[model samples]
Target: MNLLLLEDGDFTAADQVRLSGRRLAHMQEIQQVAVGDSLRVGRINGLMGHGEVTALTSSHAELSVQLSTPPPAKLPLTLLLAMPRPKMFRRILQHCATLGVPEIILLNSYRVEKSFWQTPFLQPAVVRENLLLGLEQARDTVLPKVRIEKRFKPFVEDQLPGLINNQLALVAHPGDYPACPRGIDQPLTLAIGPEGGWIPYEVDKLIEAGMQPVQLGERILRVETAVTALLARLY
Candidate 1:
């Protein structure tokens, strides 16, 4: 773990934390942290800081923390993505967090399978777990907000306009449309399709909802690969 992600419950005092389970094992096995050693730490949705190890045991580790640094800045981007399959869902969610996407909309598209929505990964607890893993990987304390939109038309027609307001919006597609812009210093709203890509009807609706179509060249990529690639290019 790049950062020791601490929860509210992990705090035993205002400035001290007690950690067990995976974190404890990670400290003992991977980090091999010793008493008086300082390690990078962050409170969830809070601040980045360092903790000095005060005590350690087989079960738990105690550290005194002082948070003085702010978390990393998030991209001023809202990602709209078709629901990926269960195998790719967790990875994509983690990628979103790692890439500093502040907001995400798990949208529905014509080519998305009905079974994809039924995955256990969509459960609130599971989603949070994956997002946390991403945050830990990126050394970020702020959690990315994930929203679900099971109905495509209503969400696209009713809610998308409000989200796209005054922002640069783009939809990733297969066509030879304008190349995806790079390193722009503007708020962005990007929509990516599913594995087989958005059917024509879905693409048209998204276009009508204010997202301009863009492309990432002729090579097709998986949903997870596309998400990381697009976010990297945009930022």
Candidate 2:
């Protein structure tokens, strides 16, 4: 991971910050940092700066961090994704982070298997790891906030509107109304569905909630592929 991320409090203890477990190994295996080498760093919801590797042992590493400035502004996009299989889910989550999507909501759809909801990757830590990998790739420190919604109608009827306030909302579907708009220059909420795609009823519900159904093409894309394509196209 190129951009090392710490929580706001993780950097508050100015004197010394200890890194253990995966983070420590990341410095060794991924960054290959030596003592006296400085690393690019940022707080989870805050600043970016340099952290000097002052001490290192097999157990942990110590750093002197300076966080006087905030990290780059994240793109204002809320991704509404139908839950995919575990492997595809990991890639999609990481790509969302790397591509700078600020929020991701994994929602349920008819095509989505009920068992997919039971995956351990839904745990906060696993989700964070996938997002961290993306941030590391983009050299971004800010992590995208993730939410899970199991019921489609409740989430769409109750919560989706609040998310799209002051934002353009688009739902990617097959054989829909028109071409997906290109380079939309505003805060956006883009929705992509399962491998088999969103059922007609679900699309109708989203439309009632102020979302426009846009088509990618006649060709159908898998959930993982569609997400990257949609984000790239929208931005």
Candidate 3:
């Protein structure tokens, strides 16, 4: 883990934190930290800083921390994604956090399997666990907000218009649409569909809600790949 993330419960004092479990194991095995050694550290959804290993033992460790630096700025993007298969959903959540996506809406589409939503990975605690892994990898502290929407038409008709009202909204779909814009300076709301792509009626609904269709290329990308590619292309 690039950043040793501390939770509110980890704090023994204002400037002190106690560590155990995965973090302690990582320190003892991977980082192999010694007493008095300094390590990069950050609090969840808080500040980035350094911690000094003041005490250590087989079971736990204590660090004296000083936090001052703010976390990196999040991308000015709201991702609206058709829920992916269970097997790859965890990786996608991690990727979204690592890439600095500030908000995500897990949407439903015609092609999405109903069983995909039944995965344990969608549980609140499990989702937070994966997002934490991403934060540690990227040395970021702020967690991205994730929402799930099971009904498609209601969300598009009632809510999406307001969400995209003043934003540069686009839907990444394979067609004869314009290429995805690159390095844009405006905030965006991007919608991506399921594996076989959104059904024509769904695409029409999205267009009616204010999102213009755009294309990456002739290549059909997996949901995870499309997410990364579209975000990278946009900014």
Candidate 4:
């Protein structure tokens, strides 16, 4: 973990935090922290700073924290992603968080398996766990807002147009369309389809909802790779 993330429960006092479990193990084994040593630290949805190890033992540790620096700026983007397979869901969620996606809409597509929505990875606690790992990797504190939309047609027809209003909206699909824009300095609302890409009807519906179709080339990338590539190319 690049940044030691502390939750509200960890705080024993305004300036002090007690650590155990994975964090303590990381300190004892990976970080090998000692009394009087300082480590990078941040609070969830809060500030970034450092903590000085004041007390340590095999089971737990205590640190005094001072937070002043704000977390890195989040991308001005809202990601609408078709729910991926269970095996790849966690990694994709982490990638979204690490990439600074401020909002995520877990959408349903024709090719998406019904079982994908039932995966335990979609559980609130499990989702937060994966997001935390991503934040730690990126040294960020703010958690991205995640929403689920099971019905594709209704969401696109009723809600999407307003969501994309005044924003540069695009759908990443495999087709004969304009290339995805690069290094654009504007807020974006992007939709990425399922494994096999959006069907024609879905693409048409998205276009009607104010998104223009764009392609990343003839190569078909996996959902995770495509998400990273699209976000990187946009910002």
Candidate 5:
């Protein structure tokens, strides 16, 4: 894991969490961490800090931590994604976390198959696993929040506004708008459509809801590639 993430109660002592429970091998193998080495650590939803490895063994390890500050501010973007199929869903979750979007909402689109939502990848544990892997790769400890919206109009009309206040909003479509802006440092709410893209009715609804329609390019892109490409361009 990048920065060892622990909840307030996860720590056994002042700074140590019981690694054997979830991440013993990660420490022992991937990191090859040694006693006396200081590692980056953070309490979930809390401060970032340093932990000194106090002890290490085959089964467990101990750390003495001192936290004084939080990790870097998360990317000020919210992703509204039409649920992709199960396989792509896994990769997208990790990509979202890795790119540092703090919130992700997976919604149903007209083209989205009803059966896709039944996939095991939607299970909370599976989603969290992918997010954690992303955090580990990014060397950050904060977890992004994920929300599912099985309905379309009710969510877009009733709920999206509050989350989008004062944010530059864009919807990724293949046609009918200027190029997606580059180097967008402002907070953004980016909506990416399904494989077949948002149907005309859905696009019009989103546009009426204050989303600025933007095209990635003439060539259609898959949901996974489009998401990463859009985020990279915005960054």
Candidate 6:
């Protein structure tokens, strides 16, 4: 962890925090700092700063913190992702968070397996935990908001049009479509598909909802790789 991410429960005072659990174990193994060592820290959804380790124990540690700096700006991007395989889903969550995606929608696509929804990683607390891992990796304080859409058609017909009203909506697919646009200063809603990609009918629905289909290249890439590539190329 690049930063010690503090939640409200960690605070004993306005400027003091107690740490244990994963963070404490991390500090012991990875940081290996002694009393009086200063570590970078950020309050969740608050500020970035440094904390002085004032006390230490096998089970816990205490830090005197001062928060003044702001976290990095988030990308003006909302990712609509077809639920990936259980294992890769976890990595994608962290990847997006670290890359500064402010919002995400775990969407259903024709190729997406129904069983993918049963993954424990989608649980609210677990979801938050993975996102926090990303934030800590990026030294960011704000957690990205995540939404799930189990029904594809309803989401596209009833909601996506309105979402695209003020954004550049693009669906990433491999085809003869336009290349993914780059570095434009605009809000974006980017839809990415599952393992085999969106079915033809599904692509039509997104097009009708206002997304212009775009491509990376001929070589097929994994969902996580595609997401990272698309986001990096876009902005």
Note the Cα lDDT for every prediction shown: 0.94, 0.85, 0.95, 0.95, 0.86, 0.94
lDDT of 2 by residue, 70-152 (tens): 66667778889999998889898888888889898889999999899999889999999899889877777777999889999
Could you give candidate 1's per-residue lDDT for residues 64-114 as a string of tens digits?
999989999999999999999998999999999988999999988888899
Name model 1 segments beyond 4 Å from true: none
What lDDT tens digits, residue by residue, belong to model 3 across residues 1-235? Answer: 8999999999999999999999999999999999999999999999999999999999899999999999999999999999999878899999999999989999999999999999999999999999999999999999999999999999999999999986789999999999999999888999999999999999999999999999999999999999999888888
TM-score of predicted model 5? 0.91
Error of 3 at 65 (Å): 0.3
Cα RMSD of all models vs. native, in order, equals 0.8, 2.0, 0.7, 0.7, 1.9, 0.7
Residue 94 local lDDT, model 5: 89
Residue 157 accuracy (lDDT) in model 2: 95
Per-model TM-score versus the true fold = 0.98, 0.91, 0.99, 0.98, 0.91, 0.98
C-alpha lDDT of candidate 4 relative to the true structure: 0.95
What ranges in model 3 sit over 4 Å off? none
What ranking of all candidate models by lDDT puts the best one first? 3, 4, 6, 1, 5, 2
Cα deviation at 160, candidate 4, in Å, is 0.6
Model 2 clashes, total count: 0
Error of 4 at 88 (Å): 1.2
Native-to-model Cα distance after best TM-score fit, residue 52 in candidate 1, in Å:
0.8
Deviation (Å) of 206 in candidate 1: 0.8
